[model samples]
Target: MGIKIVPRHGKSLKDKLYLPAIAGGMKTTFTHFVKNLKDTSNLKTMSYPEVQPEDLSERYRGVHRLTKWDDGSEKCVACYMCATACPANCIFIDAEERFDGVAEKRPKQFKIDLLECVYCGYCVEACPCDAIRMDTGIFSFTGSSREEFVVDKEYLMSNERSKDLNDG
Candidate 1:
């Protein structure tokens, strides 16, 4: 096959100097600065932790949470689908057969390393039973040690309070 070469577009003297691009950038910056100065409340910046932003979208995925069944039991069937789909492999599951036989299996130990997680939402999509979701809206998390970031099954199951935050 022959190589097809595309012709390069020629630039004028003004275009080669890039003065117009610089002026356009300066104009945009000055306009925003003047607008923010005139009405500070219109500024997009927010003083976080104390005064959270009110412009979070509906589809904003935050922290992970384990869903519950009608009987208040965990909805996860311990199928390992979530761990398999996770690109970061942050999810850890230790499955055990259920005694009640309501489900074939249940996670004896489930943990997710927040530090290693990329927040890609693959686990949520891979779940067959609708047991996992990233809709808690608890994005702002702080910890002094790495151990704190490793969320266990109990933490994920009892994360209802996190969703109540208006800031998130």
Candidate 2:
């Protein structure tokens, strides 16, 4: 069998010229602009810095944080589960044997590259010891340098959970 030649239909002058499509888009934009001008509240945007969201959802995945036990001991077992589960491969852990009875293995160093992290909760879910969590409710983070965004163990451990978010 030979290749079949399909008949092609020529586009209409209206289709050839994208002016109508552009005009429709412009019209929609103008309508929304006029509506927003009349009612500023209708726009789905918050006046950031001046106003913050009242509350974030319970499952809102924000920055990552390493949890601690009641005695102020780290909860991480240094199993590398978080690192393994991280899709972005942002988590890096160096394990050290812990002589203290608190846990078998503790992280000598744990670093998470916030810039590389996709804000996915896989790391939190992968931790069997309930060590890591992304519930700090800190969606906005700033840094002058790339190193500032790569948080170390101390930084992750020091990050406190937002009071506005549910502790549980």
Among the numbered candidates, top TM-score falls to 2
RMSD of each: 5.4, 3.7
What tens-digit string does per-residue lDDT give for candidate 1 at 28-126?
999988988999987666678877666777577788999998787899999999999999999999999898868999999999999999999999999
Q: Ten residues in a row with the worst lDDT in model 2?
A: 49-58
After superposing candidate 2 on the true structure, give the runs of residues whose Cα lies further than 4 Å from its correct spot.
1-10, 38-44, 166-168
lDDT per model vs. reference:
0.88, 0.89
- Per-model TM-score versus the true fold: 0.70, 0.77
lDDT of 2 at 47: 84
Residue 65, candidate 2: alpha-carbon lDDT: 90
Residue 93 in candidate 2 has what lDDT? 93
- What's the distance in Å from true for residue 3, model 2? 17
